[model samples]
Target chain A: MELLEYGFMQRALLASLMVGLVAPAVGVFLVQRRLSLLGDGLGHVALTGVGVGVLTSSAPVGTALVAAVLGAVLIELVRARGRTSGDVALAVLFYGGIAGGVVLLSLAPRGQATNLDAYLFGAITTTTAADVAVFAVISGVVLAVVWLLGRRLYAVSDDEEYARAVGLPVLPLNIVLAALVASTVVLSMRVVGLLLISALMILPSAVAQLVGRSFRSTLYLACGVGVVVSVAGTAGSYYTGTPSGGTIVLLAIALFLVVTAGVALRDATARRRHGRQVEVHAAHPHEHGEGCGHRPVPHGDHVDYDHDGHLHAPHRTGTGTHYDEHDGSAHPPAAVVPPVGRERP
Target chain B: MTDPAIRLAGATIGYGDVAIVRDADLTVRRGEAVAVLGSNGSGKTTLSRGLLGLATVLGGTVEVLGAPVGRLRERGRVGYVPQRHTVSGAMPATVREVVGVGRLPRLGLFGRPGARDRAAVAEAVEAVGLADRLADPVAALSGGQQRRVLVARALAAEPELLVMDEPTAGVDAASQAALADVLARVSAAGTTLLVVTHETGPLAGVLTRAVVVDSGRLTYDGPLAGAGTAGPDCHHPDEAARPPVRGYRLDQPRPAPDAVRLRHGSR
Candidate 1:
């Protein structure tokens, strides 16, 4: 409560909370598209925007938003083209952006008040009331779009080809999603910093996937995680003289590890309980172990050996090590894909 | 009000510059259960994609349910189940959510799913026999069940012509039987069916006629029993004498993307 007595702290807190809410709300779709690095890419380009603002005596945030959106559009255009050289295009844009930013920032007048580190590593304490107002508008727009078109966006992100076949305006929705990411990147620039924006967007959503039962629940859980970490990380940064971005990301990663451990523990106990119900153990002359000439399949907390095209799990009883033949049905079909080279028909 | 479910005249379907299906000609009356058979590297899937307006229409005209593919405003009326669809294992989407997207086109972009939409989704899920697993994540489903989910997704659209590309591919027999059972119900309910598959297997009983696409041509079109004679590798020696299919390329004078968008704007 004492932190709110300061105008700057209140601004930082408000901005951080908006970034917290908006980052993961848009991020779930980005991660779904396998574009987790997009936030980072936009963050890199936003630096160029910052440099342009400083050199030309304009608002850094506005320039950053424009630049980030341009980068987003480029990424979307490449993606829509569906070519193999896309990675090269992305690398060029991101690297070229950073180099350009450094050059531009260096050219700024000698008496420029802003430090590059503030943008790179988030000086949450330096947030102005005006910046907070802008953050409020951007975050409000992002959240409204997500609310209105949640299912449509999910459909397009989850399965683009299917969505298009079903007539969902795949290209337009893609552009909208790109714009959302761009706005989100700029919105998050001050709280989590440009470099660490993706972490804020991705990490919470990643953790939510581990425990969420459905898409809606996962989205809600991701937003909840986002808020908890942002607010706590902001408060924690105030207490300790640490960068807000690092503190928030570290807290997010710690939460990720903790939730991962809990899920693994729960799965292990469930597997054990399930194991107790089954009594049959396959008798085989060749015992399966490390370096066994069999395909190792990951089966939740334990590795299942693919024995003669069948999955085998090693069971340890009071007797000794025995390989229990797990049903072939347990394996994902992608693992046992029928012969390759067959045309899609 | 009355048009064949599908009508293709010398259509050559392909992607980009390469043509896969060449000079395909076929027509199916309303309510007909037709299976398009072909082998690997054959143009069957490409032909399917071309007719669905997903791929480039290299040549000729394709009409589905009385309208051109892209001009068909109600895209939900043409349900499609893609081949070996994994349903995006990267994210956590429940069966309901996955199937729910199938209704989006019919519901319009801005409109939310109403009770009727929800009922349609539930009905579609139940049709595929995944009613109990509606709330469960699609990632947890086995490959066979995922295939069923894809079918349910298409069925949710309530399309007049339900085209399923290789539904039995990579699927176990039990699931194929389940799929066939659902198709039987859908067919009985008067929705046309266009199935593309390498292995007919359990679906053989459901298909009344077979149209085999070999080397991008309709080698045979008749009863299901004769499909094996003109199997994927079976190409006639005189096929070379046939005229080439007219092709349209990007460099060619094709309709611009903006024009296409303008047409789709009303949709």
Candidate 2:
């Protein structure tokens, strides 16, 4: 509790909470759209923005925001015009952003190179009051936009062409969504950095999906999981002297694995129980004779004799007695039915 | 009667320098249900894309709803459903939300959806029999259900002309029948429809006309009853029994002897 009273720790906590809230909220949509890679791509773009800020002796946050937004807009344009898949386009953009950043950094004067290793790997210890204020503003804007247009965004994301046909300004809405994702990436970059940001975006939401059955529920659960991971990982890092971003990512991954395992185990157990019950029901037909016992014979059985003498067999069953001479002789007789209580002789 | 809902004269369609369909002239009247029939890679999609302003017109004047194709706005005037697989099915949205997108054009820039827009979305969802699943996630739906959602989305726009590119592809027979029923309702309501498809079995009786495009050229266009006899070289001989021939062409104008010989063989 005393540790939580410290200014730096409080600042880190506030920043982590901001990231935890925004990342998963956006991630819910990204994960559903199969655009999980966008987080990673946008993070790399933000890194370039940071690099540009350092080289030009400008505000890193502002430069990073501008660069990330530009990257987002470019991605949207390329996706709309070209035949490239979003993931492929994102990959190209990500690598290009990293290469450009490295080049720009190398060209800068010696003292101007502020060595962005801390930003790249993420160091919550360095977060300032100004950074926290900027994060709050960004988070508030994103949340407000998402809240206001959540329904429309949900519609457009599902089927753009269909959405357009219905009269949704799908192109503009897509741009808006891209921008939101970009901003989220930029904001979270300070906490998780480029390399591990997507894990924060994707892992918590994925875990939430395992427990959540509906869209609204999923969103809530994801937000909850994200907050928990961020708080826990931040405390663990401070106390155990571990890397903050790496620890948070690892914690999220651990949560995802545990949830996935739980769901898988539950499903497997249910299936096994279902199989056993089916077997019991099949063997003890009298127990469910009035209800489910009337189900047709199991598919593998060749003959289904009625309560009477006539064999109720499927047409595919090639019993010799059921063959008609006029029937096209395309198939050979494969089954023989014996007279009840009598040998062939 | 003076201007048809859609008209294309001497239109050549292709991607980059190579032409797949060339020298085609076609017209579709208001309230007509036209089927574009062709085998795979026969430029049916290209023709549809050209009509929808997605593909470049290689060499012809194309008009939709009395306006130049290039100038026509994709608003409530024209609704389109591309091939089912063309859009991602795993997108995160509910059925109602998907249908609501149909109203985007009406909302215009900086305009929010009104009560009327919400009503139209609901009506469209009800029309496609997806009212019960309005709140359901699209990704969780079956393929046929997803197609229905798309159709509902198109219908919500309340277009004069609805263009469906392979609407029934990858759907079950029951869903296909349901789609046919929906199309019947749409046509009965006086919306012109242009559907590009390979299998015309379920849609036979209801289709007002048939158009066939091959190699970026219009081979046949006219009444369904005439589609069978429209082209001497048409592969689907069975089509002639259903519709009248409104127009016919070949990739290369056939020599008189071969045309005569082919005509004789078809008879």
TM-score of chain B of each: 0.85, 0.82
How well does candidate 1 score on lDDT at residue A332? Answer: 26
Task: Please list the residue runs of candidate 2 whose C-alpha ends up more than 4 Å from where it truly belongs after superposition.
Answer: A84-93, A100-115, A149-156, A160-172, A211-217, A273-345, B1-3, B70-72, B85-87, B110-114, B228-267
| CAPRI quality of model 1 | acceptable
Reference A-B contact fraction recovered by candidate 1: 0.50
Q: What is the TM-score of chain B in candidate 2?
A: 0.82
TM-scores for chain A over all candidates = 0.82, 0.80
Mark the 10 consecutive residues where model 1 chain A has the least summed lDDT.
A336-345
Global Cα RMSD, each model:
8.9, 11.4
Residue-level lDDT of model 1, residues A1-345, one tens digit each, is 888898988888899899999999999998898889988998899899999999999999999999999998988899779678898999999988888888999999999876888898898998998899999999999999999999999999887777877778888888899889999999999998989999999999999988886899999999999999999999989989799999999999999999988777776665565456334443345667788898887653246898766687664556676555566663322223211211011
TM-score of 2: 0.77
Question: Can you write out model 2's per-residue Cα lDDT over A1-345, one digit (the tens) per residue?
Answer: 966888998998899998998888888787866778887888888878888887888888889889889998998888877554765877888898887777777777886746567667788877899999999999999988887777667666655544554446667878888889888877887677767888888888888766663566777788889988987888888998887899999999998888778767766664465356445434533321224323333111122323222223333224222311111211112123221111111
